[model samples]
Target: MRNAWSRAMVRGAWLLASILGSSAGFCEQMNLREFGQPDGLGNLALNALQQDAQGFLWAGTENGLYRHDGQRIERVATQELRRVAALASGGGHLWILSDTGTWWWHDGRLERVLPRTAKLPQDVPMAIAARGDEAWFVTVGGLQHVVVDRQTDSWSSSPVMTAEQLARHPEMGRLASVMLARDGALWAGCGDAICRWHRGELKRWDARSGVARQQWHALLEASDGSVWARSTQATLQLSAGAEGFVDRTAPSDRGDPMHRYPLVEDAAHRILTASQLGVLRWQGQQWQSFGKRQGLPGDGRVHALLSDREGGLWLGLRGTGLLQWRGYGRWESWTDADGLPSSVVWTMQRDGEGRGALHVGTGRGLAAFDAAQGVFRQVPLPHAGDLFGLVPDGQGGLWAATDVATFHHVRDGRGLPGPITTPGGTEDGFLWALASKDGALWVITAGKLHRWPEAGRGPVQAVPGPPGNAQEHFYDACETPDGTLWLAGARGLARRRAGQWLSSLAVEDGVTYVACGEDGTVVAASEAGQAWRVRTPGAAKPSLESLDAPVLKGRMIVSLLIDSRGWLWLGTDAGLVVHDGTHWKLLDRSQGLAWNDTSGHALYEDGDRSMWIGTSRGLSRLIDPSQVFATALPRPVLMSATR
Candidate 1:
C-alpha cells in the first residue's frame, strides 16, 4: 500500500513538473532523496563525503563521522574523534581527518594514525589524498605524506613539500585539494595555482599558460591518464605535454566553473561537477546542468558529490542535506521531514479549530504544518512571490501578506478569487504590512497606507499616515484596544485616532515594529533594538518612555509581540529577547532555536502560548518559554547551611 501511494505521488510530481516546462522527464528520469538527522546523520553541516571500497559511503560532518550502507546510516563510534572535515579511503582502510586528530579504520577496527607524542606543525588537517598504502595530508603548515606499515601495525609521515618550496605557490599554507597522478606524483590545488610535486620538486603553471591563477577547487585523473582540474572560473585538462604535463582547456567546459569540490569521472567516463546550481556533466561534447527544476532537492549548492559504483550520483547539499540520484532519471532528497519547507522561512502563524495548527509563510509559498505528523503541507498561493506575514482574520482564517499583494483566505478552507488590492495604492510599491482591526482592513504599501472601512465593506481609500516624502520607509503598524492605529516609520512611531493623524514618538534610529500590550501599553521597537513604552492619551498627545535593556541595546529588532503572560517577545537579528517588565532574557540557536536570525513580523503565540518563531533559516516552535533555560530540579535542601 505504501509503494502504491509513493508511485501515485511520483506520477503527480512528474505531471506537475511537465506542465511547468521543466526539463523533459525531470521527475521521471531522476529521483532525488535527502538524508539528515532523521536518517541518523550526526549533523546537517556536512564537510566531506567518501565511498569506501566496501561500497559504504562515509560522511564527515560537524558532529562526527557517519557511515551509510545501501540501507541505513550509522554514526562511527570513535573515541573523542568528532567534528570531521575530510575523509579518504585506500589500502583496505578509511582515513579520517578531524579537528581532534587523524584516524584510520582497518579490518573493522579504528585506530589513531598520528602518534600521541608526535609534534605537528598544525593541529587541523584540511585535505587528504590516499592511494594504496601511501596517503598525502595537507595542512596549514605544509603538505605531508604518510605510509601505512601493516606489518608493524603503525604508520609514518614525513614532509612531502617544504614550506620554502610552497612559498612560491598561491595560497601557500592553505592547500585545499590534493590528488595523486598516474605517474605516482602528487598534484595539489592551492588558492593561486595548481602544482605538481614530482621527483622532490614543485612545478606550477598560471594565467600565463592560459589557465588563470585562481583557487583550484578539485582535481581528478581520468582512466585515460587525462587530468581534469577545476577552478572557480574554468576547468582545464592536463595531458602529457612534450616537456611535462601541459594544461589545456577542456572542450566540454564552456560555462563558468562551479566553485565546488573536485570533478568526478563516473564509470561511464562522464565527467561531472557538483555545484550550487546543481550537478553538471560533460556529455556528448557539451555541458548539461541539473538543478531543483531537474529534481535535485532545494537550490542549495552541492558540497559533496560521489559517483557510486552502482551507477548512482550522491550529493551532500549544505542546506538540503543528502541527495541521491540513481541512473535512469531517479532522484531523492533527504532532509528534516518535520522542518520548514525552506530554511529561509519568512513568517509563521498558528491556526486551527481551537487546536493550534502551524501555518508557515516561506519563500516558496504558504505551508500548513502538521505538528503531530512532523510534516509541512505546502499550499501554493497564485502569484505570491515571497510570503512575508500572516494574521488571523478574526474568523479563524488568515490574511497573508506577500511581496506582490495581500491575499485573504476565508474560514472553512476557501480563498478569494483575486488579491485584495487597495485602491490608489502604488503599483511599484511592495506590500509590507497587513492588519484587520475594528472591522477595518489596513494595508501598508511602499509609501502609503490603504484602509478598507468595515473590513472591505466600503471602497479602499488611501489613508494619510506615512510622510509624503519618504513613504517607503514604514516598517510595521498595529492597532491598540481603543481603535487607535500605531505606525512605525523611519522617524519613529505615529498614531492615528478618529481619522486624525498625530506624531507620537520620534527616534533617530527609526522604529521597526509596534505591538500593543494587553494592559493598553503600546510597545514600539526600534531598528537598533531599543524599546519604548507609549502612553496612549485620551485627548492629549502621547508620551514615550524608554524601556532600557542592556541585552537588546545593539541588536536589530525584527518583530515585537506581547504574549498572554505580558512578556514582550522581541525577535532580533541576534536572537530572541524576552522582557518580563523588568529583566531581559535571551533565547537563540544555542537554546534549541533552529536559527538565530529572526524575520520581521514573524512572531506569533497560539492560544496555548506556544511561541512560534520564524527565522531566516527556518521556523521554530517553542512549547514552553521556561524550558529554554532548563534548570536542574532544586537539589533537596537536606539542611540549610550558612556560609
Candidate 2:
C-alpha cells in the first residue's frame, strides 16, 4: 500500500508540473497553441491540412474549412464541402475533395472545380491528385478527370477509365489514394494492389511482387525515387524494377508505429509517421520517437501531419485539436490568474454606457472585463457570495443576485448596503435571476419572485406567480421595447403589461429562456429545444413561427442574445449558433469553445460589438463574429460614426 501510494504521489506531482510549470520551457520546444471552439475551429476531427503557395494554412475539418494566416483563423464557407476527404495543390490553386465533390480554393475563396450544371459519374470523391493542367479525382465508383475549358471559362469532368479498362484491371477496387510520382507516373493505391499509369499503360502489382495484397490507404513519392505506400498493417517502400516494383516494409520489431497512416516527408527530408501509440521519424537510417514524454497531447494517436515552410511540424491529434512543434522547448498557457477569477461563470452583462466593457457574474464573485485592455478585473464584493445574475442599475451602478442577498454595487467595486430582503428574511433560498424594466427591478429567487421600485421608498413586493402549480420554477426573464415584462418559467412563458399579468405561450415541457429582438421579435426557447419567434404582444394574432435553424432545433439553448446587427446568437448544449437572418452557423468545442454549458442571460454584446459568452468553464469572447462569415455583415449607417 505504501509503494502504491508513493507511485500515485509521483504521478500527481508530474501532472501538476505539466499544468503549472510556466518556466519549464516546454512551450518553446513544442510551441503548441491548441485552438478549438474558443479559437474558431469548426470541428476537432480534422481530415486534411495543406499550406497554400502564399503561406496560408488550410485545415479541412469534418464540418468546415479553416484558413490560418499565422495570426488569426477563419472558417472558409464552402457550400456542400463539409466532409473533406483530401486536399491537393496544383496549377496555382488548392484542390479540395470533399464527400460531396471537388472544389478549388484560389484568390481567397472556394469555387467548385466542376460546373454545377455538369454532374460527375460518382458523387463521393475519396482522393485527389493534381499535376500541371491535369487533375484526377478517385471517387467511390471510378476515376474522373476535371477539364478546364479556357475558351468559355467553363469546367467539365469525365471518367478517366472506360468500362473495359476497369474490367481489365480488376485489382483497382475502391481506389483509396493517388499521387504523382517524380518519374511522371500516376500511382494509385487500391484494395488489392498498387496501380501505376505510365505512358498511357496501366500496370498492377500484388503480393507476388513482395507488396501486401491488402488495402493500401495512402501513397506518396519521395524525392529519391522511392515510393511509400501505407498498407493495412505497415508502411512499404517501393522502388522501380524490371518486373513490376520491388518493395520492403519497415522494421516490425519497433511495434509498427506507422499506424496504417501515410508517411509525410518533412523539410529536412526525414519521413514522419504517426500511430496509435506515438509519432516516429525515420532519419534516413534510424528512427526517432516523440510522445507524451516529449509534450505531445493525448495517447499520441495523431491522424494528420504537416511540415510547414517555417521549419515547424504540425500534428493533428485525433481528438485533441492542433499542436505545433517549433523545436524551441518552451510552452505557456493561460489560467484564472491571468484575468478570469473563476471557471464557473454564471452570467454576463454589458456596460450600459457602451464603454467596451462587460461585467461577469461568477461562482466566486463579480468580475469586470474590459475589451480594450483585454483583461479581467475582479470586483471584490463586500460580502462573500456566489453571484448568479447581474444587471445595470440605471445609475452607473449594477445589481447582482447572490446567495445571501441582492445588492447594488458601484462601478468602482464597492457594494452599497441596501439589501433587498424577503418578508421572512430567510437566507435559505438564494436569488437566481435579475432584470429591470420601467424603474422596477424584477428578481427571481429560489422560492418566489420579488419586484422593487427604483424610487427607494417602497417595500419589496412579491409579484403574483405564474398561474400553475405552486412549485413551478422560473429560469429567465426579459422586457420588450413597449414596456412589457416577459418571464420564462417551468410551465410556459408569461408577459405582464400595463400592470396586468397575461399567460402567453405555454409548452408541455417548459420555456427556459426569452430574448427581445431589436425589431420587437420575441424569441423564446423551451427546455425541449423548441423555439418560437413571435412578434410584439397584444396583436389580433401574433404570428408564431417555429425556428428552423438546424443547430438550434433539437438542442437546449442555454443562452440567447440578439445583437445590434440583428444576428441571433444562441449558446446551446452542443455549441454556439449565430443566425444571420438567413443561415445558421455553429461554433462548438471543435471551434475552441471553453465549455458548452452556457449560462442563461450570460450572452453580452459589448460596445465594440464583440460577443462575450459566459459558460460553466469560464468566459469566452468572440473578438469578431463577422470574420466567421466570408462576406461581411452589413453595418448600420451613422451608428458607427456615433460610436
Candidate with best TM-score: 2
Instruction: Encode model 2's per-residue lDDT on 1-643: one tens digit a residue.
Output: 1111111000000001211122221111132457676677758867677766666677877677787766567788656577775777766578887656678766666678754443332222227788655678776556678765555755677877777877877555367677778777778876568888777688777888767776676787776667777764666677544454544344532434234354678765667776555676665544555566445777776667777654456777656776655431111212244355666666556444334245666667767654334445677666445576565777666676565545545463445666555554255344344445577777665556777776234888877775554455666677777777777777777777877766567667877677786666678776456777775465734545778866766776666767888788877666678888888888754344545566555566655566666556555555556755656333222112211
TM-score of 1: 0.46
Cα deviation in Å at residue 405, candidate 1? 2.0
> What is the lDDT for 642 in model 1?
6
Candidate 2 structure, TM-score to reference: 0.49
RMSD of 2: 18.6
C-alpha lDDT of all candidate models, in order: 0.62, 0.60
Clash statistics: count for each candidate: 20, 21
Give the Å error, residue 332, model 1: 25
What ranges in model 1 sit over 4 Å off?
1-336, 351-357, 370-374, 408-414, 423-428, 454-457, 466-473, 536-539, 627-643
lDDT of 1 by residue, 43-137 (tens): 87677788776667888777778888756778886566687877888877788887777778888778777655433322222377898887877
